[model samples]
Target chain A: MSLEIRNLHARIAANGTEILRGLDLTVEAGKVHAIMGPNGSGKSTLSKVLGGHPDYEVTEGEVLLDGVNILGMEPDVRSRAGLFLAFQYPMEIPGVSNANFLRAALQARLPEGEELEATDYYARLYEKMDMLEMDRKFTARSVNDGFSGGEKKRNEILQMLMLEPRYAILDETDSGLDIDALKIVSHGVNAMRGPERGFLVITHYQRLLDYIVPDVVHVLVGGRIEHTGGKELALELEAKGYDWIKDDIAQAVSA
Target chain B: MNATIEAPIETVSEENDSLMTTGPDFASHPEAFRARQRAAWEKFVSLPMPARTDETWRFADVKSLSIAPYTRAEVVDDGDRAALLKKSIGIVETSGRMVFANDCLLARDIYNDTLRAKGVLWLPMEQAIAEQAELIEKHFMRESGVLGSAKFAALHESQVKAGTFLYVPRGVEIALPVETFHWLSGEGASVFPHTLIIAEENAKVTLVDYFQSAGDDAGFACGVNDIVVGNGARVTYVAVQDWNRKTLAFHLNNTTVARDASALALRLNLGGSRVRDEAVSRLRGPGGRSDMLSVSAAEDDQIFDQRTLQIHEAPNTSSDLLYKNSLNDKARTIFTGLIRVDEGAHKTDAYQKVRNLLLSDEAEANSAPGLEIEADDVRCTHGATSGQVDMEEIFYLQSRGIPLRLAHQLVTFGFLNEVIERLPGEPLQQKLRELLHGKLG
Candidate 1:
């Protein structure tokens, strides 16, 4: 089982600016695949399109999550179908406590007429919060409202752990975290790795890959995966920036 | 120690069908009160209805203010009384509670003995008029109407006969809140409910007023409540207004704060066809503070018009007002608030803020915030914001698997709960949250 995207073409719905053009990749089950790209390389747009954001229209593409096409599905439907996206800039929901927000997300997964057991839900939530070193008061606080940068990132990871989706897309989860926060956040992500789940960890820095080592790394250029290699490619990219990859794509296109 | 006796209250005679007629029951009251009622009724008749050209009636549906279709509410039958009593549950525990249905007292219970031993006067308005005539005469309806509801306030003064009267003596602090439920039932029924609270020096107390209807019937409700906060005293007053969608209503309020005293007044408007609420807070002594807050949800052709004035008459006094409204499905809301600082009232700090969340394209919200400061060194800030719910917030929730409808509700509740959380007590906040949840659901 895997999440396979074939020749995906997308553009901004408002301005018709193409962001994802002829993109392709596969995240197989039991693997952590890292997609490293430069700025404006459609990393965030890819996550948003995969999550079926209304602002982006998929002109041509078929995103199959375990043989089920999710392009036509709504964002919430995609999430409930075992596809999770950890946003780069998590939103602050004023007045809705984090506990209540997470509970609602979990509650939507239940069948009709079946209720989520509150005791069990809280128990699991507290356990995951403990792993992320979150204070008990955060459960009562509004979702990410007035939170520090590091705290918001931790909250995103905490949610990813609680949801436990089959295929998780973490879009720049390491952007705002400090060293201590990075280690803690990486620990939470590493704990979720197993044989049954797949992860598409999108990051620009090699520092994140050093902690949660990727099984495979792909260099993305011009909205497409230009090259694929072992995890060492992350170190190589860090030593020599994305210029080499962009030049390599230029030469290939000229040929 | 003074003892209060149950006095027999005469219901408004049915034969006197017109609301303008002063029936025999009006004559039965004490001469001083009867004189005041006679004068008020005369004033109510002399004053013309609010017109569209009037400044106070701006942005309001003046046509909906007609009271000709409503008459005095008749006493309810046994079945409706039983049902209303059963539904009067607001908070699980209270120091005391009184239930009234259709202007008739259904039940009352006092749960605290220490407060009574300390000379706390908690009685129905009718009984309080009989037992503490001098106290009731001096403080009842003392403030003149100034927030565009003078005619309606005069009408209420002429017709109101039942409500709650609370007095806390000096240095007394009642830990639990006192509650009163006012339920109106039947078609074309009208009820005039009143609440008067007085807290002496260094006293502390909380009171909640519940205005609800027994069923979905077309009716009219005109209510007036006034509070006097003595020196260094603290008072919290909450009014929960939930009438049937087919009913038109008015709630007029006034508060006077003394030196070093603080007052908080919060109103939640959840139901009504067309409702006009006017609240005026006067800080007459130095170091006084008042917090005026309101949250309303208007949907399905409902109209909620709110007018407020914060008058700072003393130096170093402060008043803060915050109002939030959520409108959906052709609903409309109008908010006009003014902060006035009189001459020589230096160092006065006042703030006013109004926020409206429009959920549908057809919904409308109009806001006007004004400031008139005659004193130098006074600080006053006022603003009003009208906008739709943030779409990014909804996307964030949807990314976590929450459905669109639930996401909208969560955001709306969060917007309104910001004011609810400013309240003092936890139990009271919980109860208000439950009521807000029911409305949102």
Candidate 2:
């Protein structure tokens, strides 16, 4: 019913420097929740930790996807468990065509000895590609190789649309998009906003919030959510900046 | 059947003399074949083992050149023949196929009757010597082994009896490829398989040679292949060597390109305990081009040694070489290639590149690339690189829910496919890819 993280604490594996001290968040189905934070506020670390990346070690955390603990799962296991992370910097895999890569992923989901239907796969792929306004030839081209900045983000959305995971974490998906690409990507995400799926949008700037408006906006500082408010909080934070919250959090910690 | 026969007979001496005297009559008769065999034996014995200091044998295990333990094997029994034939299957849509076991032909499948009627010669080497004696003599082993396997070359010529002889007349273009399979049978057995191709002016053809073992028995194989490309002709040659894990193999190949002719040769090495390959391409006329490519998958205790030379001997000629290797476990691979542009070969363009993908900490790869240019207004470049699998590439595949083993397989396939995709024939490429996939499995 929801992706709930309770008292999540993570640290760097190399130095053991704690990044996420105690983070708590909940994203329910049929709604988009946005996390807006300042630089060094551990926004990217939270996304990495949620995705089960090996670099970020979870010292103490409980991540529940539909009441199932996902903290002990591997990164790929998390993916198979209906958790999808749209990497901020999507990797470019040379020599692996987009169609083949997507087919392999879909094939992994099928039972042994049961082959994927090629006709149906291509039809669905073309439909999803059309929805994202991508050229048909992109399927035959290498995955994200030689793609422009906007094209890479669009490719991430294309994968999200195809996989159709229960929960999706868009990690700064709007950082490099132009106005036109932003509109197209937001349209793609909007079409998938339904009761069966939940989204957690992480961003440093509030510009993306203007297009894909979130129902709830949270201010993240030093790994934990310090303030929660309605959608207007994004506009206020954009105008007032994160300095006020950093000062208030410092005083509270000192006290 | 004749196990009591003496190891050496008086017939061997007469065979040696016949081989040394090359003439038209020698080209046609079985006596010439015996003489060539005798001469090859003497030459193989007289030539000393390659030393470590020898430039061509650098980074090689010279001691692995032992040939005394292996004796030539006879045909296999009927019971084991069927299994060997089944394993020899390659390219389902080939125009013709010839399968050989222990220097003996087991089966011949010539599907294209029109090509046969058009005077396109496709037969075994011995058969061709009898039927197309003049043609076989004109092009058989016409070039010397300049890549530094002259000793093995002599051994191959001495014992060569069964192989493919393909000749396409002028203006004839065979639409499908011709395949030849050579399989080693008994323990400590040795087989010499030869392939001679002559594409006349304006003719085009493709030939594939597959070397494999009947079982897990230890064996040795010394193969020689020579291809002649006439004016305005195009020829493609592919060799896939998949001997048993305990087998030692040596394959020597030479290609001669004439005016406006192009030749492409690709070798895929998958098996064998120790394998040494020497390939040379001579661009002999203007507008001629040669593409020399190879892919090696060395695993366990396998060792692969490869040497190549591209000689641009004519004006406006070109040559390009790309060799790739993926080493695993305690495998080792050594590649040395050179591009030489002779004087007066102006406007020549030559390139040589070697890339090694190391998959294990214990695996080692050594590469040496050189260029010698004496021609004015020519372009030549040679380079060699050795590196492990890109961590980011592996992580990228792993992030997509693929397991570590499958990820490695994908990366290795992709690394080798770069060379395979450049090949001109689709059926040959597919067969090679399937063989590589089977080896990986």
Q: Across residues A115-218, which tens digit of lDDT does each residue of candidate 2 receive?
A: 99999999999998898899998986777889999999999898888888999999999988999999999988998899999999999888898889998999
Which segments of candidate 2 are over 4 A away from where they belong?
A15-18, A111-120, A133-140, A175-184, A204-207, A236-255, B1-29, B425-427
lDDT of 1 by residue, A1-255 (tens): 999999999999999999998999999989999999999999999999999899999999799999999999878889999999988999999878898899989999999889999999999999999999999989988899999999999999999998889999999999988999999999999999998899999999999998999999988777888889999999999999999999888898899
lDDT string for model 2 (B1-441, tens) is 333322452333332333222211123346655676567667765776788899999999888877656766766988777887887788878788899988778899888764574878888987886677577667777665667788778767766667999889998998888889998998878888889999999999999998999888889898989999999999999999999998999999989999999999999999899999999999999999999999999999899999999999999999999999999999999988888899999999999999999899999999999988898999888888888777566655655666567777777877887788789866777788788889875
Query: For candidate 2, what is the DockQ-based docking class?
Result: acceptable
Give the lowest summed-lDDT range of ten residues in model 2 chain A.
A92-101
Which residue pairs in candidate 2 have backbone atoms (N, alpha carbon, C) closer than 3 angstroms, thus clashing? B15-B35, B19-B35
Q: Judged by TM-score, which candidate is best?
A: 1
Once superposed on the true structure, which residue ranges of model 1 sit more than 4 Å away at CA?
Answer: B1-17, B21-24
Please state the CAPRI-style docking class of candidate 1. Answer: high
